[model samples]
Structure formats: structure tokens, C-alpha cells
Target: MTLLLSVALFGIHSLMFYLLKINTDSYSYSLLELYGFFTPIAVFIIIVLIFVHRKNKDAVGYAFMALTCIQMAANYFMLHPMLQQNLRPQKINFFILFALFLAMETIITARILNNKQ
Candidate 1:
């Protein structure tokens, strides 16, 4: 789940670079900044998942649910700054994507937890 979120973020970052015509250096920096920002949280989740899986394999799905929450939080934080910026069409598209990702994450987390039980 964590990897999935990372991949999604990377993909979005790439798409943004292409569509926004942002400078290559700026695009690379933005990607690294966002990726670096999320790294510690993802590592913590992985550590917890490792420990939980070691104690009980059945709890792995719960780890994924936890990851969903973390990813959603990351997404929300990523956009928090954008919300203050002047509105633009691309930013609006990003907002839609953000909301859609959150909704999908909510559904995925619920399903994962339900199956875990």
C-alpha cells in the first residue's frame, strides 16, 4: 500500500511537470521535497507492519489500512499549501484528483479492515 501511494505520487508529480511546464530543476526539487517529506512516515509504518506481521501474520491487512490513512494524510498535507495559492485550472484539477484519491483511499481502507475482521 505504501509503495502504491509512492508510485501514485510519483506519477502525479511527473504529470504535473509535463503539464505545468515547470522548470526541470523545480520539478525535480518538488518531487524530491514531497518524496522526502513522506519518507519518515512511510518508514515508520513499515516498521510497525514488520513488527505486527512478525507477531501475527493476519494483521498485515490492518497495516495496509494504516498505510491508507497515512497516504491520505500526506495527500491532504500536500494540497494544504496549494489551497492558499491563486486558483488556476491546473490547481483545480489537482484538487479534484486529491479528492478522488481520498475517496478511493477511504473505500480501500474500509474494505481492507472489513476483510481483516
Candidate 2:
């Protein structure tokens, strides 16, 4: 789960950055720079949570849930304002990713809890 989540997260972030470069209309170096900060912090937190809670798979799911919640908040407050746009494609995708991450985390947690019982 950790590996899969990490890959997904990396791929999305990379795609966003790459797209920003190719598209002049959506270009915002300041926003990209801020997102860069989030990228590293997210990676660090995910790695730490995965390793530190390796023995407990359920705990890993919880960590992902927590991270997703934080990411959602960051997306709304930091990313949204910096972009200075409403109803953009990138904004839509951001919410989609957040929902997907939340769903995955919730399912994982439910499965883990069931297995324990």
C-alpha cells in the first residue's frame, strides 16, 4: 500500500509540474515553487509513516488517511490562492485526487480492522 501510494503521489505531482511547464496559460512559478515545498514534506511524512509503522499495516493506512487530510487542506488554502483561479482543471483534479486518496485510505483501514477481529 505504501509503495503504491508513493508511486501514485509522485506520478501526479510530476505530471502537474510537467504540465505547468508545457502550458503557458497556467504558468505560475510562485505556485509551483510553493507546491515544491509540499511535495518534499509529503514524501518525507509518507516514508516516515511507512517505515516507522512497518509492523502494523493498519497503522500505515491511518497514516495515509491523515496525510490525505493534510494534503486536502494544503490544496485548498495554499495551492488554491496561489493559482488565483476558480473551477480550473488543475483544481478539479486536486479534489479528485483527494477523494480517491481518502477512499483508498478508508477501505484499507476497514479491511485491516476486520482482519484483526
TM-score for each candidate, following the candidate numbering: 0.47, 0.46
Candidate achieving the largest lDDT: 1
Model 2 lDDT per residue over 1-117, tens place: 644664666577668758876443553333345445454655555565546465775577667667767767766675556368653665655555456555655565455445643
Model 2's lDDT to the true fold?
0.57
Runs in model 1 lying further than 4 Å from the true structure: 1-21, 24-29, 86-117
True-vs-predicted CA distance for residue 37, candidate 1, Å = 1.2
Superposed model 2: Cα runs more than 4 Å off: 8-72
How many residue pairs clash in all the candidates, one count each?
0, 0
Number of the top-ranking candidate, with TM-score as the measure = 1
> Clash pairs of candidate 1?
none
Q: What is the lDDT for 66 in model 2?
A: 74
Error of 1 at 44 (Å): 2.5
- The lowest-lDDT stretch of 10 consecutive residues in candidate 1 is 24-33
